[model samples]
Target chain A: MLENKDPNRTDLRELGEFGLIDHLTQGLTQSQPSTIKGVGDDAAVVDIGGKYLGITTDMLVEGVHFDLGYTPLKHLGYKAVVVNLSDVYAMNMQPTQVTVSLAVSNRFPLEALEELYSGIALASRIYGVDVVGGDTTSSNKGMILSITALGFGKPEKVAYRSGAKPNDLLVVSGDLGGAYLGLQVLKREHEVVKVNPAHQPDLGAYHYLVERQLKPEARKDVIALLEGLEVTPTSMIDISDGLSSEILHLCKSSGTGCRLYEDKIPLDPMVISTCEEFSLDATLVALSGGEDYELLFTIDQKDFPKVKGNPNLTVIGHMTDQGEGANLVSRSGSSIPLTAQGWNAFQGE
Target chain B: MLENKDPNRTDLRELGEFGLIDHLTQGLTQSQPSTIKGVGDDAAVVDIGGKYLGITTDMLVEGVHFDLGYTPLKHLGYKAVVVNLSDVYAMNMQPTQVTVSLAVSNRFPLEALEELYSGIALASRIYGVDVVGGDTTSSNKGMILSITALGFGKPEKVAYRSGAKPNDLLVVSGDLGGAYLGLQVLKREHEVVKVNPAHQPDLGAYHYLVERQLKPEARKDVIALLEGLEVTPTSMIDISDGLSSEILHLCKSSGTGCRLYEDKIPLDPMVISTCEEFSLDATLVALSGGEDYELLFTIDQKDFPKVKGNPNLTVIGHMTDQGEGANLVSRSGSSIPLTAQGWNAFQGE
Candidate 1:
């Protein structure tokens, strides 16, 4: 039996998500010769003979990650799979297979699960990954979905979070802040519906933001594009926890600092307009509003010519020596220290 | 944006766990050349060059799969990893890596999670598997643990559930029913403690059963023993959902029926005594008591000589023609049809 009244118990919120992970996994030695990298990357890299296998897992809880009041079961399932595939893609591997596990309460009917599975099936078909194996069980409350994605690549081509070097050009794929803005629109509409059951609010103006939040895509195409252009990222990570947080991750892992330009941060017109309507700073939203699911990487300065004119790729900044520290250059020309404002699940609601 | 008042919803309990999986994954098509087998097996088989890779996942939810009141955090963590590894071992593969994902509410303190992770670390060390990757998030209610295990084996040496043929001897590693009996003893003791909070039940008499319930091990040693003896099973599966349910799974996949001799069922002395004290039928307990975590396989009659006198294995039955149907040959010389009485998570508690 466990002691429920321990006086020495430390609150989980004190350490936050990343701190808890580090503290819990400290000194975990790997004995498998095939394990090339573990725990500290977007995906774990394992050597399967001559090739490299990338494995990663992600979990999404109903209340913490999404609200069924606005999020459909199909989209939730699709988003769950995409988020994990994004990790594999961040590792610069070709996504091949996934295992999906779900724990749901009795409130979810058979038809609801069917809807969820359909979205997973759609993602599998679109991404060309086989749904290999999984387990399903009942939970006492809301649904919890956990997905593990596996991908393969050449051992030499496998990218790690700790491979960045000073003077490398920092780049990101697609836009930022749209997914977070979309979530705001959905949550607002959900509150309105709760007060007025028959209300049907028009969302045409927020279409892009809503879609970005509900159906954000992983950057699988970016991996292929980089290969076609003959450019390999020195280090890469998926932007799930906002731009500033990811930049900090790359910096910490690679032992380098970065200088991100505020003007260079990509944002869709809808995201910009939504931020104005909500009276929020667009730059701050891009910096700390998580769940973008875009690939952020660094390329050698010499290789910049290959992606120079690519519309899908944007050069936002450059890596600096670790002693310089991570910072953002504001539009007013002042440099400010970058801090991780990423979503911490352990924080009290 | 979603309709919660749908009148056409079907209850999940209608189809049960296996039926739900079958229904959800009915038309999934695998386009990957490396995917040798997908779904409907203990673990998915993937061809990574000349070798086979095994991928499997399992989820454990609080109140459904386990209760923290009677289960120690360390044992819970260890059991979670062992359950997934059992599937890989059933496929005749050597587990090399695992990804453990946990979603816990703020109710769990940092110290509590450390105890859980310590158990997981111990299992990883003993099982010789690298803790490659995982995701941690906050759940709305209780804790949910999802683990994915990866293993490797020679393509030719890999065993499948569909490989059994007529006349193959059905063999099981270790004794049956102990784990189930162990759970019963724990539940009984738990009830006693609940009625009198200060009472500490002496469980010395039920030590073996309690250990079996609290710390069941996957038969990785049995896999090695089979290899050392040069015995390749015609078919193999792990007994997680009790003997009858697992036997049915093998029969369904292999397209054969089996003649399971009730008298031949192996039971430990403690299991039998515990069953007697509990006023439960030992045969029924062995038939439907789940979570045994023992390897069950079919071997050719010629290879039976290799394991004939092995203390670790017992030949309890023989595969029969599909027309024979699955039956239990009772010690009284009467035949009875086998029914799956495995624990279905969807069933009402």
Candidate 2:
């Protein structure tokens, strides 16, 4: 079925973008009836309970999204599912199914994809999310992964990004910056290995940081925590970009600002030491380093004591009025304007 | 900022799949009032409508998902959004918003991205959907598009793929197989051009076929069409993988079987000629060429004439008893078992 097309040939311009997607998604296996509409509409329609439904998507690519050389196809598959479920979790909903679409180059053997799907299946089982639909094709380059996780959520219980207010105590689950440090350490070790191919630097001590970088966890715990604590956040967002940038988003969307105490910022000891070792700013890591799957949320000051100082919870900051602006109050009583940096670095990259 | 290193690079075998994802999306940026939970959990939670919310993800890779050498990014983006929307739409609801994620290598310039987004933005507008959230990253090879569309449907209006019966008519909106033929023309042109670059083939003559390939529209119109016709498919699916595959899906899910008449298969006249010119079977194109984006659905037989001969619809087949099995009866009274040749081609590719 390779069809004998020149591997090094075929300009994408030969087919318009539409032609390409059509060719790729062609012969897709559309599997369900709740999929009232699929693939060829403004939005695919689903029927969940004939009353409410759910929708979410995640994107992954080679190089920018994943390093094929360093990353295993299986974990990449698992992470793809995890990423989409993160959104579903953010919505306070449960997922039922997912549609996966992939792009691959010939560099990947059939064995490679099976490995990827193995991880996808495992994650699907663990999360109770089914792989119901997807698209797959070859790429001219490395690879791409796009998966849409569909689930059921009563519309009345759905969450939006715009509901935080002043006096809401800002809290985050788990410590921060360990993942960033993990990246730093991994990058450093990778460099060393490149220069000295035989150097067997055992990074056993940095296992947590390294693992945090390679296998991220979506905070299914917070949902359990919220259930256990019997408390609900007024507003919330995920920590994908970084801490400071996320704060700026809450402020921008909720018509409120924040006041952060430098001393109060939670930092994993491993993250701190790694930052020091690299002469990198740990505070900046907490603020701008991306990819920590923790939850940043605001609860009424009334519920503060219920979770405050609890394990896995941190009093990182407090919400303020828009006029006050988002600021960080230092240990010395100085306040600095909060900056949004996550997206900027990406834009430059 | 391109900080790169990791000891794992020294021993590829040491870096397994799970380890890589952890490294890739670790230390995510945290923000927003609606995010109750994020990456480190079963699912992320957001606040919406004064209720807890959920989000999930999907990533569509290149070659594995679509053939960019044949697909235009514009339609690619539009279809990307459509694919995500289908999952949500399957719940029988209205889609409210979407976030598109894309990975493109330097092979694509800023202008190329602009075109892709233009289609996405246009589709968003057409669907009354908003581009509220997303991710954009770099890829090492081809362009990778991952789109997550967010939608809301009242619980009652949402439908599921699980609810069909033996008596259902198995209806579908819009004609079938034009997009398949569109590819035949495009591929022929591509081969012709490959052999002799100077030949300025008259593509204008193949308007409909070309349009079907490059500008395949989503059946957003079908949702409205059904509402106007005062008919709803008992079980529905979009014609993405070819009609036969979809019929089998409905049968398998409904625990029933189906029978269809070949003479009744839907096709535009141009598709007939195009298939003939290419020395391909028109039925084969309808059966497995895929990407029609039409709706394949089942309805009560009472609703037949109401939809039959509708400009956008065709009565190609019907549902049958479970023991009947899926079969296609030709105009000459010959019966053949329907085969899943369409989806099979991708696995080989």
Candidate 3:
């Protein structure tokens, strides 16, 4: 039991997600010379002579991150590793090893674990990262997965969130809003199935969106492409918490502002159709919808010629001075303030 | 929903803890040049030129690792960090940074998390390790804490479980069985409280044991002391799953045998008295009771004199030829085979 030392217990929601993290981590000191970067980054950078080692961790709780009714165990495991690797890639580093810790209840049998591990093995094989170590134990409820990914890159090559400069071109890899729309479809179908177990909903139309939600891949190819094109990003981050939130993080950390052009925002045709079907605004969905797992980065204006015609790359915005603030310039010529509607599992959403 | 592809499903308990890990990790290949060790060590070693970086992870699930009714959140936080650090210490390395991830239910408020972080911060300050990064999210059920500790040591200074040789002196740091006895005392008191809420249990008699269970510290001192004594253990492991289990692990990994003297096992007077009070065998309790968090190591016979007459170090046994097998020489002059009845959380015990 614990003694209530504080008479007024502050609710977690009152602090929100980022506020809570900042409050708890304030005044924390790094005591290691190897620790080049501690918190407030895509991954903590450890100086290891020839290159810096980027370390990052993420936890996925069942029911909060996924619904078992629709999520396959193999996909859950694969996505768990991939999401953490995305953070490493966000640092512009090559992931080398990972530690996967799992806590599961008795409901999962050995075969279920094998399927989960098979997915982890598949990810490791494809990502060229070694499964170095982990801890497996029993949980009181459902499954919880925590993955820590380690990566490395030269000091000059690795990107940080605070490196964006004024006038830097903002770029994003792939389309957005698909994962969120896919989740909405899955939830709707789940409700339908609950009402009638015999009902088999048609999902062929939303195949691409659903796949983006279930099996999102890290932009390892983008990193390699940048190297081949000799274009290094000034600032980079993985788009896990929606575009608005991630861009705000870059702007806040770099002491700059951004103006995203709504006309240039990339969206797959399927994403637009799904948004229309669901009666959701495509622009709003693209701005606030999370779990895209795409790479959002900023590059110098000099590198524009290298990435201008690349099909995988989209120039959506540019950095501005700190006084301008983060905004989205609409196609109608109206400026809208960007807000972070990032998904917070703590709010029980 | 998931379709059962396998008709026959095996329970996790059938495979036991180690068997399940072995089955899941079988045929896993390491392809990274930076990865020196994977899967089967106290910590995974990564090549970093001047020194090797050791990374290890451990997860603690509520209701499985600790009972919140008897465990304080602050102590739980401290113990969670310490247990993972013990793994890093087991490799004979100095821990530098740690990443902590917690999946907690909404039952806990911001103040509760602040208390938990306070304990974590205290441990980091005391151990001289930096809290580099962590993920804090919501869990569907109870709390789950996962910690990844990073450390570094010279290649020659790092000790692995497979490095012990025949005739090496088997040594253990501190006393065993106190933490297990401490848990027993707490559980007994909890039962009393459940029967009558007004009952004030007298815990003064089991103060040492209670403290051991509530706040077990890793052997950071032993690592420093060994260095001071100019002693490099041939093989080392932390006694997390009882003395017999750890001895067996060392023997199994090193491909050797061991002979432990029953009288040589260091035990506090309180452990002997408490074992008598509980009508339990003290020798058996010391042999099989887990969570001691002491260091179990092997050193060359030439280093015996250096460790001899040291109160903190106990020469419990010696490594023998592979064919000899692992045995415990009882005070009655009988040879008893050691078995690993170590705590398996997956068994729901």
Highest TM-score model number:
1
lDDT of 1 by residue, A129-238 (tens): 99998988888888888999999999888888888999999999999999999999999998999999999978888888888899989998999999999999999999
Question: Candidate 3: which stretches are off by over 4 Å?
Answer: A1-7, B1-7
Model 1 error, position A278 (Å): 0.7
Model 2 chain A lDDT-worst window of ten? A36-45
Q: Flag regions of model 1 displaced more than 4 Å.
A: A1-5, B1-7
Q: Could you estimate the TM-score for every candidate?
A: 0.99, 0.72, 0.97
How many clashing residue pairs, candidate 3? 0
* Worst lDDT 10-window in candidate 3 chain A: A1-10
Candidate 3 residue lDDT tens string, B1-349: 2335354877677777777778888857778888999988899999877889999999888888889888888888888889889999999999989998888776677877887888898889889889989888888777788899998899999999999999999999999999999999999999999999999989998999998998999999999999999999999999888999899999999999999999999999999999999998988889889899999999999998999999999999999998999999999989888898787777753
Point out the higher-scoring one by DockQ: 1 or 3. Answer: 1
Tell me the deviation in Å of residue A284 in model 1: 0.5
Write model 1 residue lDDT over B274-306, tens digit each, in one string.
Answer: 888889899999889989999999999999889
lDDT of 2 by residue, B6-86 (tens): 432222223232233333334223333334444422123343443433333445566555666567777777767765555
Q: How does each model score on lDDT? A: 0.92, 0.65, 0.90
What C-alpha lDDT does candidate 3 achieve relative to the native structure? 0.90
Give the fraction of native contacts in model 2.
0.14
Estimate, for each residue in A1-349, the C-alpha lDDT of model 3 and write its tens digit: 3434465777676777788788888857777888888888999998877889999999888888888988888888899999999999999999999998888777787888888998899899899999999988888788888999999899999999999999999999999998899889988998999999999989889999888888899999999999999999999999998999999999999999999999999999998888888999999888889999999999999999999989999999999998999999999989988988887666743
TM-score of 1: 0.99
